[model samples]
Target: MKYLNLALLILFPVAWFAPLLRAALLPIFGMDEISVITGLQSLWGSDPAFALLVTFLAIFAPFAKTLGLALIHFGLLSPKTLPALHILGKLAMAEVFLIALYLIIAKGAGYVTIETGWGLYLFTVCIIVSLFISHKTETS
Candidate 1:
């Protein structure tokens, strides 16, 4: 379980790198508007079907990640930090959800895109693996 927890922590940074790298490199590399976050939006905003898919993902991604975080740290942290971690768990999902909601409702398309970059996919996988690790750790 400890090994798994360590593995999950390791996974987080690796998963984050793909989108991070693209977002950092795209403009410098002469790739116009190829942001991992906005690229997805630009790619699918025109189509209602794809847009809905992106919207759903954007809404749920944070929830999934934070929930994993919550489980990962729950009861494992020292008592003094437990409350803080709990609050963090609840709050961590907010950013992406708000951004996605704003894009879908206010922007009404054309301002951003949703592409589900490699980082996003990897992060999702990492969250799932983390959850599994959390469960296994808690039982033992």
Candidate 2:
């Protein structure tokens, strides 16, 4: 777990930056664009319900994890921060994976034609690495 956490910590920074880096290079290099991974693009063209969905997910998701982390850090919960971080990271990854799955399925079904944006791949990698790190560091 500790090793995983360390790996996550190292990868997390990379993931965070990968999307931006890809975005910068894609247009210049003339790469085909695709669905969004972690930015406002996901919100674009979404229905009104999407706004509510985003709000609910955004608030509740981070709140739970951040609260748990706070509890542990402030002595309200366990002394370690790994569990909270891991669980939060898991939640984050689940959401990203689901979105990616949805996009892939949509494209396969002809509902949408994705263009393979570099940001999506980078974001996916980021979430996966974060999950691994969180799980590695998590403790009972």
Candidate 3:
């Protein structure tokens, strides 16, 4: 579990740049790949508020939770912090929900075509893995 949490230090960053969605406003045009980084870039320019929320949920939350777990694993931090870290994991999960909601809305609205990309699954798996590690860590 310690090693798995540590692995997230590397995996999460890769997931960030991985393409989360491929969206095309029109079927005739090439779809643009939107990764966490690209989506943040877009949001930062047009909506700094949402950009901050996403940056926190998609990046900060998981990173913090992973780091917290790492510290606990190494005995550098107390396990009492686990509950707060769990909250962070839930926040990370929220980002996935946001993406799914966006996809649903875009698809239903009909002018836009949105496809789930590999990155979405990668990001989700990382979050779930982190949660599992945290749970196991707490149990044992």
**Best lDDT goes to which candidate?**
3
lDDT of 1: 0.47
Model 2 ranges with Cα > 4 A deviation: 1-49, 52-79, 109-112
Model 3 per-residue lDDT tens digits across residues 83-132:
99999999999998998898888899778988889999999999989989
TM-score against truth, every candidate: 0.43, 0.48, 0.96
Q: Native-vs-model 2 lDDT?
A: 0.48
Per-residue lDDT of 1-140 in model 2, one digit per residue for the tens? 33433444454445433443222232445543333324334564576577456533433443455445445544577646565566665666565655566566655753333454455565566566544434433534
Worst 10 residues of 1 by lDDT: 20-29
- Kindly report which residue stretches of model 3 are placed more than 4 angstroms away from their true locations once superposed: none
Better of 1 and 2 by lDDT: 2
Query: Ten-residue segment with the worst summed lDDT in candidate 3?
Result: 102-111
Candidate 1 residue-wise lDDT, 1-140, digit = tens: 54555565566546544562222222334423233345456647667786565544443443444444445555544434434433443343343444346435633444433333556556656555644544454455
Clashing residue pairs in all predictions, respectively, total: 8, 3, 0
Best candidate, TM-score: 3
Sort every candidate by lDDT, greatest first: 3, 2, 1
Q: So what's the TM-score on candidate 1? A: 0.43
